[model samples]
Every structure is written in C-alpha cells, then in structure tokens.
Target: MGNGVKAEIIAVGTELLLGQISNTNAQWISEKLALHGVNIFHHSVIGDNYDRLTSLFSLAQDRSDLVIVTGGLGPTDDDLTREAASEILKKPIFEDQETMRNIESYYEQNGQSMSPNNRKQARIFEGADILKNDVGMAPGMAVQKDETLWIFLPGVPREMKAIMEQSGFPYIQNTFPNQSPIFSRMLRFIGIGESQLEHELRDLISAQQNPTIAPLASNGEVAIRLTAKAESETKAKELVQATEQQIYERVGDFVYGYDEDSIEETVFKLLKEKNLSISAAESLTGGQFVERLVTLEGASSVCNGGVVCYAKSVKENLLEVPKLIISHYGTVSEACAVSMAVNVAKKLESKIGISFTGVAGPDEVEGQSAGTVYIGLYVDGESPFAKRFYINGDRDMVRTRAVKKGYELLYHHLKQKNY
Candidate 1:
C-alpha cells in the first residue's frame, strides 16, 4: 500500500521565479519530509500571484494528501500565500490572540513599535494548529481538513530549517506512525567520465530495487547516489552498504570523497593530517587557489602563504623566478611552472609548494594554446613534480578545471604516502 501521506512542496515566491534566489527551501523540505516517511511526489514553485497560487493549490489538494508551502508568509501585501490559501480552501481565518500577543511582545522586547501590517502575521486558518516561530515574527501553521494536511513555513532558510526540525518533523512523525526510514549515501568520484563510470557499474544499476544506485553528472564531476528504504534506519543502511560494496568492487578506484566533499576541503584535510604546509605562486588562477584553501577552517595550520604573481616582473621580483627561465620557456612552459613551485616554496619556507601558471583564454598566450595549464607541486623533503593538462571549455572552465586538478594532485600525493 502507498504511504498514506503523499506530500508536495510548494515554494511560493516571486523572487524564486526571477532567479533572485534559489528554491533551496523546497530541497530542505523534501529531505525533512523523507525522514518522516512523507512521500514527496512533486516540487512546484509559483510566483506570488493570487490567481496562479489558487490554481496551484487546487491541483495540490486534488493529487496530494499533504501540501507544504514555504515563502509568501511575510507581512507585506505581496506576501500572498496565506491569502491565496484562505481563498482556495474557502476557509475563514482569524488572528490567534496568542500569536498576536507574541508578535507584540517581540516588538516590545526589541524596543520597537509594531506596525499595523505586522498583525497579518498572527492570522491562521480557523481550527488550525499554531506552530511558534522562535526565529522570526511570523508564526508557522498546520491545517487539517478533509483528510488533507497543509503546513506553512517561512521562506527564510534559518527560520524555515529551525521550525521544520523543532516542530513540523516530530509532529508529522507522531501523526504517521507507520513511516519507513529513508537512507542514502553519495559516492563522489573524479578522474572518470559519467559514461565510463556508468559502464563499469551497469551490472549493479541493472539489478537495483529496495537499494537503488543512481549515477549522476554535475559540472565536470561524477557521483553515484545509493539509496534504500526500509522499516528502520539500521536496516536501510545495511541495504545501502551491501550495494555500495558491490559498486566498489566494480569502480571504487575512481571514487574520491563521499557525500559533499569540496576538492579543496579534502586536500586541506589530507595536508593537515600529514603535517605538511603548502605555499602557492599563482598566475592564471589569480588568487583562487589560496582563496579556496583559506575558505576552510584551520587553513592557517596547513598554509604558510601565497604570491599571486600575475605579471612577469612580479614573478621575477616577488616570487623570485629566474628572468632567463620565463624568457626562454615562456610562463606557460613546464620549466616556468616547476620554477614557480620551487622558488615560492623557498620564499615562504613551507614544505610543499603549488603553482598554477597558464594561458586561459578567449585567446592564446606566447606559443601556448588556450586551455593549456601547467601545475607545479613540490613536497617537502622531496623532488618537485609538475603536470601539464589541456582543459576544454572557455576561460572560466579552464580556470575551474585547473583548480580541481590542483586538488587532485595534492590528494594523490597524500594517498601515495599512506599506501
């Protein structure tokens, strides 16, 4: 039998339509609902137009047992979710005295006067359960009518996340006692094409059911998301792990990090664990290499510093690369790349040094073609290593690929030491 509650997430916001902000709320709600055994069939994003929202709501009620809406719950006139919801369901709404008092008290606590328009936030559908919002002024709500449940949450991510975790999730779990536990693990991979990875795991994907293997490609990277459904989380995880082991036997070597692993984060972690410090001398990547490294916490422990020597003179003066090397081999040459790494490591007194110098372009530089990248990596107490790659796509693509390659280089170096 199908799960009793088939839910649909409706993100009501004009800005979402205009691409002013992503519909991240829908994604968050989907994950939350899945944990509560709520089946999310569709995700719909509609602007704040009342007529359109009413049509969307009617469709949702017809097909789904539960409708969860985020956004358009603000106090402004354009905040039309509640208005549209009230009209579509033909449910008369009144301001809950408790919510109104809370809103007033919030303003009082902050030493600010409440606007008359802010009173709109206190209104709820008659007989609906009021869900308090500890994060914001507008109170959330859960309405029940004719075997259908509607939950309204604020658009703000922090506010929506808090209310869902604290109130909405537990309430739904209690309401639906026979909910299955949802489990999934993402296997991240690099150094392989999606087509190639799929080809290797074709046998596994062909034979999936309760535990499913889905391979997906994003940007230039590939991943396999393994998911399972079972009565309990432990059983679900067992189901997933069984399939993961099978896939691993087939194509595990290509796998890098699991779930959400930023290339830089993985590299940084490895470098820190190994007690290795790195410095950078950047050219085409500008400061992107160092910028990405510093983005992670505890970067200072693993990074000495970097010199973004974009100019030929700066490379010679600041990074102290030999003038003869640049003049003879040009900046894009392996010699220049290797020298950039070695000299910067000496200058910063760091053990490991990495360098990115290349022609990324709408046009080529020196005699080198566009998308021609050379990276220099020098580990402390070891001879330096340099790799040359021809990356495809435009200027930004070339730069992005270069950064990913930089991470791959560091990861491989760390991996070799462990082995």
Candidate 2:
C-alpha cells in the first residue's frame, strides 16, 4: 500500500480556458480522490496544444505519483491527449479489438452509422490497463511510466464519474490499501454571513487536526464542511459528527439544513410535518419564491398558490394593498409587504403566507437604492411582520437573496412555534 499518493489533475480543452464550459471535472475528481485518501497537489488546465500538454504531463510526472487527465479523447482533430501521452510514455497507440467491438455495438444499437473517425476512440497506449467506459464511447486508460501512474478519463462528466466509480475506485483501493479516506459533511446555514460563521468557530478552526472545517459561501447561504480522515468510513463520520456537534452547540440557530438540503426542501418538509399549507406574494423577486417551493415533489400538498405582484396595481388590486399605501410607501415598504402576505394567505386559504418586495435594480426605484429588500410573513391567527434588508450585488443577486431570506425567516418562525 502506498503511504502518500500525490495526484495531479490536468484538464485539457480550449473551451475551458475560453469560459465556454466550466472545468467541473477537476473539482469532481478531486473530491472523489479525497474520499480514497489520495492527496491532489496541483491542478492544471491546458489547451489542446500538443506541446503544452506534453510539458504539463512531464511536469506532473516529475512531482506527482498519480496524474489524472481529462478531455481531448474524442474523435475530433483537436483531441491531442492520446498523441501527447504516446510521446511522453514512448509507447505507440494500438487499437484494442474488444473496445472497437464495443464502439461498433454502441453505434449499431443506437441505430446510427459509425463514422470512420470513431475508430480513433478504441486506441489504447501500449501495455496500459484499459478502464472500460460503459456510459460513453471513449475507453479510459491507466498506464505506469517511470515511477508515476497516469490515468486518462473522458471529458464528459457522466462517463468520467461512472468509469471512476466502477473501475478506478477498485484500482485505487488496491494501490493504497492502508491509506485512510477523507469523509466530509457540510452544514448548510442561512440568515448567517460567512464571516460570522467562521468567527463562531474560530477556536475550532485554529485548533483542528484530524477533522478540518472549511466555510463556503454562495449568493444567499453559507456552509461549513467538516472533513475527517480515518481508516474506515464510519470512524471518519464519527469524527466529523463530533466536530459538528460542537459547531451546533454554538451557532446552530442559523443552520437550516445539512448537505444537499436546500432551504425550499427544508421549508416543505417542515410545512408537511406541521400539516400546513403556504402561499406567497412576490414583487421584485417575481414568482421565484413560490417557484422554488413547488419544484419539489409532493409540494402541492403544502403549497397552496402564489401571486407575482410585480406592478403597483397588482399589489394594490390583487393583493388588496391599499392604493394609498403603495402611493405613500411605493410598494417596496414594510406595510406593502405585510399587506401582500396577509392578503395572499387569506385569498389562498393557506395556513401561512410569505411575501417579497424589493428593489432589484441597476437603477434606483422610487428613490430607493438597489438591493433594498423587505420580507413579510404571516401565519394563521398570528400578527404579521416584515424584515428589511439592504443586500449587496446585482439585480439577480438581490432577488435570489430575497427569496432565500423569505424561506429562512419562515423556517425560523415555524421552529419557534414548534410546528
């Protein structure tokens, strides 16, 4: 078993450099490799230029024990990975008969004519182990050159993930039998800024050893990823959970969900549990707040209906916000938001109502600056209230934050009511 297997990722494609597509393959591969305890020392993105690829491959071989390359394995002229690898390994590319048969079968089964250039997908480097691609045409390869191991994968994310999971994982397990894997869990929090979350966990972050805490922030949310390394998955999770408990004891109030749990998901789950139904009235956020809720499965049971009161007339006429109020407060006020929330709940006969009214703008509206947002909430038989916020960013950012904030407030309110 290798004690320390340092891996380097080289993503090849001019599209990645031109921002035509994101280089998500590197990020995904890095996370997958971390699970098996392989440390990634570097990541590089190069164009389809043969010289540049060859140079990067050679550099990776010099410093890294394992080199993983993605892209440039297609049948097109610009797919230079195979040619570059051939030059570096001093090995000729040969057609693998079985791989060729698979490619032919794929085309035949799909009722498509196979192009002559498609035969290029079956070529493999000399003396290399073939990584079967069940999901795609190009077969991946693993070769040992000098002291380093080189792995080449397809650029398509689905094919790469499938090949790595089915074939690559077993190979890694065999190569690094004694290495401990890294396990991570992310705690998702809303209504909290990244800086504040980090500050609350400052002591834990500084004194970390086995389990490490990393805080990540997006448009309207923050997440703390707790990663722990251990021999077994169970042990690693236990370490992460212990660290998570300490975090929860401190700043858990702001936490709404765990890894992969969206605020809408949490809201729906809680509403369903409480046997409640919801509706929303939105202005600057448009229908985004309700759209998020209804996207989830079985959301109809908890989601009554919604109205996008984007215009002042809609807010005054549809949601019953008085014309005088819109004239005075300009539809972006707390009074307007409260009226929308209360009227939407009454009109839809829902147990709860949420509203978003804001200025998501490049230019000021009604003399109000951009990013001025107000969220209103009304639960059945409860007094309605509104919260105002001056969010920062562009129009889309303001709208997104406004929607998320509405969900966060509702979630907190539900929790407080023990519903």
Candidate 3:
C-alpha cells in the first residue's frame, strides 16, 4: 500500500448497538492512529453474536491493511472476539503462560482462587504477538493473516488504553516504519453556517493536497480540520499553518477560537483582556449563559453574577425592568430586553450587561412563536441595544442556541471594540 496503512476500527459489544454505551473506543483509536499517519477509513460496531462478528471480520480483512477490534475480551460467555478471530483466520487459540501467571497472581493478591473461565483472558492466536496489559487481567494480542494485520484489545477503557500505549503503538511503528506521522488542527468558527463556510473555501478544498481540509458542523458551530503529514511535526505544522492563513484571509471575522475554545470561554477571555466585568438577566435561558461563564477559571474576576427572572414580576421588581416597557411591548420584546440589560448592569454595578428574553417552548407566548428570542447588550459608556432571532428547535435546543448566540454577540462586539 505504498508504505501507507489503511486501518479499520471495529467495536464488539451488544451494549454499543443498543445505545446503552457509546462507541468511544473507536473514536479514541482513530485519533491515535491518525497521529501515527495511519489512515482510518471505516468504523463498525457489532454485537456479541459470533456469526455477525466473524462476518464483519472477514469483510474487514479483505478491505483493510490493519484491523483493530476493541471489547469482547472478558472471561464471560458473551465475550466472543477471540473466538471469531480464530474462526475467521483459521488459527488455533492457545493460552499464553505469562498472562495466565499474571491473572493467577492477581487473584492470589486479592485472597481468592482463580476460576477456570478466567483462563479465557489469556488466550492468544497462534503465531501472534502478546500485548501485555499492566492495568488489567486481559492481555491484548496481534496477528498478521495474509496481507491484513488484526489486533484485539479489551473493551474496558483503562485496560485498552494501557495496552495500546505500552505495546500496540510500538508494534505499529515497527511494522510501518516508513509511514509519516500526521498533525491536525481544528479551527472553530461562529456566526456562520457549514454550507456557507464550505462555499467560502471551495477553491482551497477542491485543490487540497498534503494538508487536507475538512468542514464539520455541530451544536450551532462550524469547524475546519486541517491535517498534514510529514517526516517531522514542524513541517506538517508549517503546511497546515499556510492553509490556515489563507482561510483566515477570507473568513477570519467569523472564526472565534481554535481547537477546544468554546464561545463562553472566548467571551470570558475577551472580558478579561478588556478589564471589564459582566452580569446577565436571563429569562427563557434560565441563567445558562451566566452558568457557563462562572465555570471558567478566574471567573470571579469578570462575572458579576446574574438574575434568572423567568416571571414578569421578577423582571419588573427584582431586576427593575421598566413596568411600562414590559406592559407596552410585552416581556419577550426588544424594549423589555434592553431595559433588563441596562437595569441588571446598574443593579449589579458591572461594566457590561447582557440579557436573554425568549419564547423557548412547544407553544407561543404573547403572540410570539416558539424560538422567538431577543438578546440585549449594554456596555458601559455605550448605547444599549437588542437583537431579535428566530431560532429553531425544542425547548432545550432553543435555550441552548439562545445562550450560544448571546456569547456570539458579545464576542463580535468585544472584537469590534478591540478592547
């Protein structure tokens, strides 16, 4: 395969298929393989059924150069990964004495006798390398059948990670010595849709090579993942940075933060940089905006607290939102939002104030449809204003998007002021 390995991760568990547990192992394995420059092309989740497991194993062997299977390695009858592998590859399964000794030693230390079934944890395919597990009883194993290499690891996250780190990665490096490592960076953006972001970078995506560009959307935000492969990390980074600079030249304004920087964290950082503090008056969002801000480190320095004024009386009395404005334009209106923002800032003695008032529901409020939201912002020495948005989703989704949009608005304003 020209020194490149095409890998597939197969997670074996009925719980995963039933949605009782997430297939997080596959995600973890894929990320690790990427660092080794292994191209992971497929991920499959199969139940404990022996026939289905063997069928999937046959298909993976035919298509992939390296196949990694996680889970189904326990001592229970339902654990069928090793059996399926043996059947598919026609290899005899034998117990490794080193692993059996370790398992027996563990039971001895626990003041108990080892059970007969526990020997299953020590089983390995003929002519395979035994991957020692320092964290658990099950020892992982790897075998090469024809052109395909198959690896079996425990389903338990702790044990699987230990084996992979200790033996799995080393074996892979030895096998694929000529493969170049990969480096990737995620550029996160707000105030833009996925299709629009893709359209803006169409040329770069179409002519992509070396460092490839991928657009992903999740939870009201879009991200571009730039991946590059090179002999050294520095060279890969340089390639990715060159592409990143070009993307910024076109859509930098919408780009908020890189990697794991959330909108709330971005806003908090801006507030810290500007030496400003903020308080919120939350309605339909129920203090969610302020909750996120307060969770960050050093939040006490910039967060002045907030008021969850869900009731109109609390808005008029607690936050001192003007009763006349609420009566004239309704509580879910721009006038009320502006009044709440300005008054909350005055009451809390903060340098900046933000407010959320919305109809987040399965029903309408005051002739306004569900998802009707008004976000108000008041910065000290600046005019207070409110923006209306028609968000779409259920109650929880509407509230979530409303909070995200609030952070987005604050981010843009702080960015524009350059404070």
Candidate 4:
C-alpha cells in the first residue's frame, strides 16, 4: 500500500436516501477500513439513477485509488451498480458459469423457481475477480477501471459482513501490499474525564510516531483509541498493545472496559462469570437501569426484578421506605435511596440491589434543586452506600447521568469486591 491506499465509499441504493433502509453498510466498511489503516476520504450516498451513479463512480475513480461500493447487487430492476459499472468502464459483462450453477442449486434446494433476472446475479466484469457471497446468492466483484480499483458488495448487512471478513479483508490486504494497514485498540474508561485521562497519559500522547492516541467522548464515558500503522497486521497490534499497557499502568483502575464494551455488557459478563445476580430500584431511572442490565443474554440468572418509585407514596408503600423519613427528608434523600436499594434486593431475590433517587428535573422538588442526584448500592452483608452529585444539565440529561453513575459505581464495587 502506498501511503495507506486512499479510499472512498459509495453507497448505491435510492432506498438509503429515501430513508427506507439505513446505509449501515457504510459504517461497517468504514470501521473495517479503519482497522486496516485505510483512509476513507469521501462517503458518497447516491440513489438508483444510473446517470448519477455513473458520474459518482467516475468522480471516485479520479480521486481515490480504492473505491468501495455497497448495495445495488440485488436481482431486481433497481439493482443497477453492476450494469452502471460495466457501462462506465466500457467492460462487457458475462455470466460466470460456476456462480450460475451455485445460484441454480440454491434455488433448487429451496424448491423455488428462479426468476429470469436472477441470471444477472452471475454477471461479472470482463476480467474482474469474483468475491463469493456465502450468505446470499448475489456474487460480489472487484474490478479495475481507469486505474481505480472498485470493490462491489451487497447491501444486506449480514451478507456484506460475511463476505468482508471471509474474503474481502484478505483480498484488500493482498491487493494493497505497498500500503501500511491501520490497526487500533480502544481503552474504555468510566469515572474519568477526557482531560484528566489524557493528563495522566499526556507523555504517551505527545511522544507518538508510528502509533497515535486519539480520545473520543461517549455519553458520560471516554474511550482513548490507540491507533498504529505498520506493513504487517501483527506488528500494528503489538504497537497498539504496547501503547495501551503504558497508559493502563497509569490509570487502569478507571478503565472498566475495552472496545465495544458498554458498562451494561461489562456488568453482565462479570456477574455471569462469578454466578452473581443483581436487581435495581429505579426512582429517577423508572426501571430503565434494570431493563438495560437484563437485556443481555443469560441475564435472567442475575437479574430478578426492579421497581420504579417515581412518587414518595410508592417508595414508602412498595419498597418499605419509611413514610416518616420521606415526610422529613423527602423521596430524594440518601436515606430514601438506601432504603430503595435494600428493599428492592429483598423483593427481587437477587444477590445485589441498586437504586436511583434524585431530582432529575427541570423543576425543583422539595429542598433539592434540579440536577441534585443520589445513587445507592446495597450488596449482601455490606453497608448500603450512597453517592451524591449536583450535575448541571436538563431533566433527561440529569436522569441519564444519574443512571450511568449508578452503573459505574456498581461496576467498580463489584470489581473491587470480587478481586
């Protein structure tokens, strides 16, 4: 690869622009390209009109050395990428007999009659390399036209991903041997700020060359993506891992997860592994906390139930929070939060119970101001601990922030307790 093959993504489906189907394929391809250090210079989304598609293809050819196109490989009339590609490149399309036999056999096995247009699925460029679609009948192709390499893929997400992982990634690797592939690892950290986290690892960030550190913000959390470029994939990962180790040595405690690891996922994995279970009492979250936890597979083993005590009466009556305490301290107090947590665990028959109680509001409640929040955790044979925050945001933001803080505390507590 030469200076990491410059690439452009062209999504060829009118349905995408029409908002009928999302262009999820672009995101998948872009992430895959990033992993290999491919630089995506442009992302062009065009509809089914052949003239516009051809013009877009021509423009891509002039600007990028490698153009990745998704969609328009279907057997219907709207599927026009292959035809447009042949016309724009002046390459004759011919049926691949092997692919044709596979398609025919697929239809026969399903006991369905093949449509006349299905024959178009077997067509390829005059001297193009065929990419097999294991998940679907439509065969993808890689063709060279006007010094630009074009990679065509199906629009269906599963079909596209299967081909990319099994064949497409390898194909691009072989074709672009001169360009260095990009590789990256993301360190997911909670209970840390973007600035503070970087401050701890500023030395590593400032002194960078082959590998670079880029910090990204995600809803109340931060992920520092350590990207490294090298001719070999193994070398690139080694570079990333080395950088990650140095950073982790400084602030690994705040690091709760890694790439694609959400707080909920981390909680579920740890709980499942240790054969532990959890339940929640959501005052501000309204059962949202437990819903997020139990959404993962096998969560039923740990997650039993939850309560949404949006009102003082519910907290007092349903969760056994003393009505006298609420009358004195209101529903958003630390006592109320602790009670909610303890009671919910008893009610749910879970090993642990957590609760959210706060003024997640645009309006003040009782003596508390908007953004005033409390999170309580109650584990078996441990004291119920509550943390308070005075976050400044809108009503939804405050509630969401409070919910995330509860999980972060839960994650840290569980990690410390188990280890």
Query: Pick by lDDT: which candidate is best?
Result: 3
List candidate 1 stretches off by more than 4 Å. Answer: 1-4, 35-37, 108-111
What would the per-residue lDDT of candidate 2 be over residues 1-419, giving only the tens digit for each residue?
22488888999999999999999999998887876778888999999999998888878879988888999999999999999989988889999999999999999999999999999999999999999999999989998888788889999999999999999878767755788777888899988899988888899999998898889999889998888988788999999999999999999899888878999999898999999999999888889988998889999999998998888788877788988888888888898889889999999999898999888989888888999999999999889999999999988889988888888898888988865
Candidate 2: worst-modelled 10 consecutive residues by lDDT: 1-10
Q: What is the lDDT of residue 160 in candidate 1?
A: 87
TM for candidate 2 is 0.94
TM-score of every prediction relative to native = 0.93, 0.94, 0.86, 0.88
Top candidate (TM-score): 2
Residues 170-214, candidate 4, lDDT per residue (tens digit)?
888787776776787888999998999888888878888868899
Task: Please give the distance, in angstroms, between residue 356's alpha carbon in candidate 3 and its true position after superposition.
Answer: 0.8
**Candidate 3 regions off by >4 Å?**
1-3, 87-139, 144-147, 157-167
Local accuracy by lDDT, each model = 0.86, 0.89, 0.92, 0.85
Total clashing residue pairs per candidate? Answer: 0, 0, 0, 6
Worst 10 residues of 4 by lDDT: 173-182
Cα error of candidate 1 at position 56, Å:
2.6
Give candidate 2 misplaced runs (Cα > 4 Å).
Answer: 1-3
Residue pairs clashing, model 3: none
lDDT comparing candidate 3 with the true structure:
0.92
- Error at 165, model 3, angstroms: 4.7
Better of 1 and 2 by lDDT: 2
